[model samples]
Target: MELVSKRAFLQMVSPLIQFKRFRGKINIQRPRLPHFEKAKYLAFTKPWFINPKKDKSQVELCKGFGEKLFEKDKENPFQEIIAQELRRWLTTSRLVVFYHHNPMNAEDEFKAYVMFKKQKMHFKKYGKRTLEMAVGGTPYETILDLYVSHNMTVFSPEPEIKKMLNITKKFPQLVLLAGILEGKLVSKNDLVKYSMIPSLQMAQAGLVQTINSVGSQLVSNLNSHQNTLVSHLSERAKQLEEDK
Candidate 1:
């Protein structure tokens, strides 16, 4: 038997076997295991096997140390813009009605928006923080407490209280809360009373009628004695002429 060179043997077998060259760097570092400061009690049992009281205690244990976990690093640019717009609306609009906005479907909300738009009123919503930023240190600041529970705002150039109330009746989702009207904070009941009040034109007409009635009565009373005296003199002249 003849002993063959290893290189010669490999060269002969290399044609039958193919080798692949790796293109990426090979990582040889060992992965380090994470250190656990305290061991947590992970439940391995089924839901039915878990004790309700113990589960609740475990949940409480997992809670943070009564501190807020997430804090806003900075205000969003859009949020600032919204706050500015809110201030402008509160300042410019003659009527600002705040409502506790109950959830409504898209169709109903669309209808409500259309109804408000037709009346030339604007419906707006903003975050609580945005509202506080906008309303603080302004005349409307008194109403800050009303900015709770999905609150929404409605703005109008005119104090069309009756019209707005009627529109709200059509959409119950917008529960009337409180509003600022003509620079006065008015409650829901006060708004109702205000809606019942007569319009400016009607009130003006009624006032004019009252003044005219008073003037007519005064003229009639002043002319009454003068007319009586004139009638007596005319009768006296007729008697003298008859005698002549």
Candidate 2:
């Protein structure tokens, strides 16, 4: 039964469907101990000092130590860290170090990494759209949308890059060229040229590609089953097939 469930879990994380994790590293201050007490709150937990394999008895309500540390007073700690970490993540731009593995599944981790990585691109796209809305300017769906939609400007193509894009003659099926750098979105083809990557949606496509490249049959099955279950709930599949 457990194997079946784990198989299902893996399937849900399969790259074809593009599952992601939004994990955040947390390093808040631990509780201070009383002069009489032996040590800090960390000392209370057995795992930090003693048995590494077993889970330590969780700490209870004590303001930041509890409220800031764990979620719903449950055994899960990663989710709690995520909540706090996101609050300051964009602002700090700090690297989150992991002492141990996150408790969440691979899907959640994938989403988290994508979200963190593509955060800047999404933000810039949002900013452009927001500004465009004020002047009745066309807001692009993606950063590329701004250029492709308006033919805003022609990029200075590199000598090799121009030849590379010209390969559409040899590979007729080739559609687009994509490149990412420090959360920037860039695309160029035989016709149009480079610009920032635009939105979360675009990032989602890239995420999907990554997942499919690193294929996992189990994860695909899980995701497919979940999709089937969802589609059944809405009767969407039946209606779509009927329409066709």
Candidate 3:
């Protein structure tokens, strides 16, 4: 201790001095993680306008919106959350866009929106740009039926969506813009016609009914022939007995 150099003493006590200074006085505040609140607010507040120059297609538009909603980082936590939601909608639901030509008053719009929400459907307005609606499919059931004979799947629009469409028809102001079915973009006319097509379950039931009717008619025809044959045989036997 008597031979201790000033620099050596200071170095040895530096750690202790720093520890004492920090003890019972140190507080840490972690930096807040990035979030999608701003992005989401912008999405909800703004309409999704089509820019022919920038947005070449709906797929491109969706991707761009997704990028803007989340961060560009490959492992961003907020991005993952957004990706999950987008995947769920894209896979499990049918997306449709409608043009709201006649703007509804706040009250009517609220009532209509609430009604749709009660049916497990939600619509978002992109101001005058586009109105998007997502109609979720039934749980644990295939929304479309595949035809093995034709190697094609039938387009069975969800009944809930059809009901909404019917409602919109009555409104006259809300017009169908386009629909995404089985990853294909369809025009409004096609969507409306598709909705009119019988669902898979209904088509199957109709087929079964027709088959049963045909089988029943065939059985009745066979029984009538058997009865006539027996009658003819009985008449011949009676004639033989009388002649004997």
lDDT of 2 by residue, 1-244 (tens): 9888877754444456755656644345764445655556546764735654365444422455765656544443554444343333323322111111214455654554444333321111112223233223222224333423211111211222333334323333223344322333444432234223334667899999888866886688779988988979789777888899
How far residue 180's Cα lies from its native spot in candidate 3, in Å, is 1.0
Better of 1 and 3 by lDDT: 1
**lDDT by residue (tens digit), candidate 1, 163-196:** 9999999988899999989988999999999999
Question: Which 10-residue span in candidate 3 carries the lowest summed lDDT?
Answer: 146-155
- Which lDDT values do the candidates have, in the order given? 0.85, 0.39, 0.55
TM-scores of the candidates are 0.62, 0.14, 0.46
How big is the positional error of residue 136 in model 1, measured in Å on the Cα after superposition? 2.9
Q: Cα-based RMSD of the predictions, in order?
A: 13.7, 40.0, 23.5
Residue-pair clashes per prediction, in order, are 0, 19, 1
Which candidate leads the pack in TM-score? 1
Candidate 2 residue 118 Cα shift, in angstroms, is: 32
